[model samples]
Target chain A: MKSDMSTIVKTVTDFLFGFIIIFGIYIIIHGHLTPGGGFQGGAVVASGFALLFVAFARTFLDKKPQQLYGLFESVGLLIFISLAFLGIYRTFFYNFLANSGGLFGMKITQGINPGYFNTAGVVPLMNMAVGFEVACGLSLIVYLLYRGVIEEGEDGE
Target chain B: MKTAYAVIFMSILVVFLFTAITTLHPMGYPGHTEMDDYFIKNAQIEVGANNVVTSIVFDYRGFDTLGEATVLFTAVISVVALLRGVKKDEE
Candidate 1:
């Protein structure tokens, strides 16, 4: 038996889910240029996922999404490490791409100015990697706990 | 009495903490600003990142972020180990 919430919760969750996710991505991608960073953005995204779980509990009865969350977290971590390794030519964690005139190598403006997307070298990449890891990891944590609670409730009944 | 001794100890500790806080350098008047100046001046040119904090975090001090990520990874792994046993029990 799959138990879910009412129509109002379902409607609200559906409406806000996409916005919350987009906000998270926005925070992560603009981390180098803005005030917020990867962790903050990831937490926001995870909270959106949690909101979905809450509003429509039965929707996540399947374990496949939970597993996918874990896998996505691992992939994020791998990408982060690979990016760090790419800077090995000079030293560990060196900014090799800066000023190289390639991807993410825009000449940084000194003072306040409108920032460009294809700048900041590995900062945005690292931000995305960390955002992916944190969002997936936290969502997975919430799902696992929720699953445990549901199981315990079933056992008692 | 024991109550008197406890009060004295607490007062002394509070006084010591207060004194330490009072002795700390005033805001924006630190004992050392050389490193701060260097990062602010050079972060953009050297790191090519507009946000100095990001460059300092992901480039100049990447190891710190790595350590933080490791800690998070460990926490997730521990949670999985604990919760996964429940599913395994049925299998």
Candidate 2:
């Protein structure tokens, strides 16, 4: 089976991959204000990585970047778990930072108002952690599967 | 005979599922909404987030998210372990 796609497909993927990643990051960062969240945005970014894997197979296999992605995945999960443990004095996953007037802890205006990015205490941090974990994990998975297929093909011959 | 029994079973199952769906509460009108109302009203002031849903997911129900993250991590680890040496033998 052919590992990489045609010239046109590779060119299009090169053109669009950055935009997809940027859009996913936007969704992740604005998760508290918008409809999207960590998992959804991470999936979007992973799709971009998938496009890259399909378009530039040689680049992926030669670099072995999946190991790096795996490391990032673990780090993101650690950050998430640590954040959860931070409020253990009150309770597990307690909103100790909310309304505390420090680091994403501004009091929100009650009624209709433009939401502040500085508000929403530990939630945004957790969102970013989960987004990072999910994006890296999914991208690693895609790279592994693609590499597996390529290796199997090589072994068959 | 087996085909006739399958057809009958499928039809019965479909009828039951459709009846259950049709009898359920209408859209946007749940039978129990006290929790929803509380979250909607207090999540803003309590969690200090404009998006009530985010507060609920990341704060009120954070344990579940932790569980989800654990599951995802486990899956990725397993995938990596399984596919680690696929090309090594050839090299």
**Best-fitting candidate, measured by DockQ?**
2
- The i-RMS of every model, in angstroms, reads 1.1, 0.9
Superposed Cα deviation of residue A17, candidate 2 (Å): 1.1
TM for candidate 1 is: 0.91
Q: What are the candidates' individual DockQ scores?
A: 0.71, 0.76
lDDT by residue for model 1 (A20-124), tens: 999999999998887777788999999999998887777686544867888989998888889999888878877777787898888867877677777878888
lDDT of 1 at A101: 85
Model 1: fnat (fraction of native contacts):
0.61
- Residue B13 CA displacement from its true place in model 1, Å: 1.9
TM-score per model over all chains: 0.91, 0.89
Over all chains combined, what TM-score does candidate 2 have? 0.89
Note the residue pairs that clash in candidate 1.
none
Model 1 chain B: weakest 10-residue lDDT segment is B82-91
lDDT of each: 0.85, 0.89
